[model samples]
Target: MRKFIILSAFAATLFVSCDDTRKVLHEQYLEYVMHTDSLDVVHDAMTVHHDALKTDTRTLAQKLKDVEETDSIAIADLAKHQVLLKEQATSLSKLKKLIESHADVKSYFMSDSISVEQMEAQLVEMEANNTDIAARLTQIKTELKMIEAEQESLKKTEKH
Candidate 1:
């Protein structure tokens, strides 16, 4: 009878230990997945913002050239170009600030103690803002081209 009791107790202890071990392993796996996701978000955000800044800078330079070359430019038209220039400058400044912030995020993400949830949230918001800025840059380029076309039309009318 004593032998039977000892056998049952040994089996119960083994079962409990196994369950505990499984729980710990599952929790660790989840933590690893979340950490990896956060790192991916930060990396993707940085790449997209870098590409956008490069393209926007090129577009702004071309617009500036057009503004400078405009002949017999009306004061109102010049004012419009100046406003667009100011807007482009502001966008460029914002992009520069984002580049600086990206470095900080990268450093923070490297630490295990940092909150992955908050980092992901911030990265998502930053990506949305960057996309908006890129769209605005495209719109500005289209408007600048329209202005150039109008100036050319005026010149041709004057020639005739």
Candidate 2:
């Protein structure tokens, strides 16, 4: 009777151990899924930002051409546009870096050996970072549009 009791205790311990491991594995899988979803959102936002960047760059180029063609404009006005162009270029460089760094989602996430809690923390942090980057990209694009519109108005005034 004593031996039977000891064996039962050992079996219960093993069963509880297995259950714990399985629970952790399940949690890890869910974290991975959430991580993937966050990455997808980031990718989509970045793509939209990239397209806007391209369009804004083309607008800047056209504005530069217009500024060069018109001799009536004040040097100060041209300089302002030039400075805005430079700022836009700098912002584009930053956007490119952000995109390149996060484009490879696989490297950002670990599939094995990481604890569930760690994975959740990492995912939350990444989502926050991506959100910030998306906001910056949107701001830059809006600034570019405003500058482009101002330049267009300047051109119209010069023509009149």
Candidate 3:
């Protein structure tokens, strides 16, 4: 009877050890799945943003052909559109980096909102780049309008 009890205890210990390993493996599987899903979402968002940026860039190119400095109205509108494009591009880049860096997902997530610190830092840098791009774009648009106005006035004088 004493030997039987000792054997039972040993068997229970082995079972517990196996259970712990299985749990760890399960958690790793779950993490991989979750990470993949998050990356998919990021990729989709990036694609959409990329498309939008292409459209905005095309619009700016077309606008440059027709908008003059004299037409302050169109100039301001184009600047605003450019700013929006810059913002979208920044957001797409940040999400892409985040997805790429997050190879591991914790099983005990206190909040679904948790994120990797390095990824977040990359995102912040992207945002700063966007801000600078926006400012530069605004300046260029202002200069473009001035040149357009001068050209329009020259054309007007020639017509006279």
Candidate 4:
């Protein structure tokens, strides 16, 4: 009877240990899914911002070409702004590529070989990168707005 009691207690403990391990794994899986979803949202936003930047660059280029010869100063300023815009676009494109390369979230999540600590470290790095990208996008948007305003001011001066 004592042997039976000991065996039953050990079996019960083993079952609980397995159940706890599964619960922890499930939690980790959910966390990984959330991180992937967040990344997707950021990627989508970056795509929209990138497209807008391209459109703005084209518009600025057209304005530069259409400006009157007499407005050399305005043309020079517009040309400078266009150059800046091109550089930003290039940087953004590179960033987008980087993000694309790191977008294999599913494979990483599904792999049993990867340790939890390693996955957590990767998530931290990705979050930091995402933050940097978001800040750069905001800065680019602000600069674009300022350039557009300057162009409008130039147009007003031309009318006079």
54-138 per-residue lDDT for model 1 (tens digits): 4544454455446655344443454565565566556556655554554555545544444445555655655665555556555
lDDT of 3 by residue, 39-138 (tens): 5564575456456545744555465655444355545555665665566566556655554443333332223243334334534543454454445434
Q: For each candidate, how many residue pairs have backbone atoms clashing (under 3 Å)?
A: 0, 0, 5, 0
Whole-model Cα lDDT of every candidate shown, in order: 0.54, 0.59, 0.51, 0.67
**What are the clashing pairs of model 1?**
none
lDDT of candidate model 2 versus the reference? 0.59
Per-prediction TM-score to the true structure, in the order listed? 0.45, 0.52, 0.40, 0.63
- Candidate number with the higher lDDT (2 or 3): 2
Say which candidate scores most in TM-score: 4
Instruction: Write down the lDDT that model 3 would get.
Output: 0.51
Clashing pairs in 4: none
* 90: Cα error in model 3, Å: 2.3
Q: lDDT tens digits, residues 129-153, model 2?
A: 5666667656766765665576567
Off by over 4 Å in 2: 1-74, 105-110
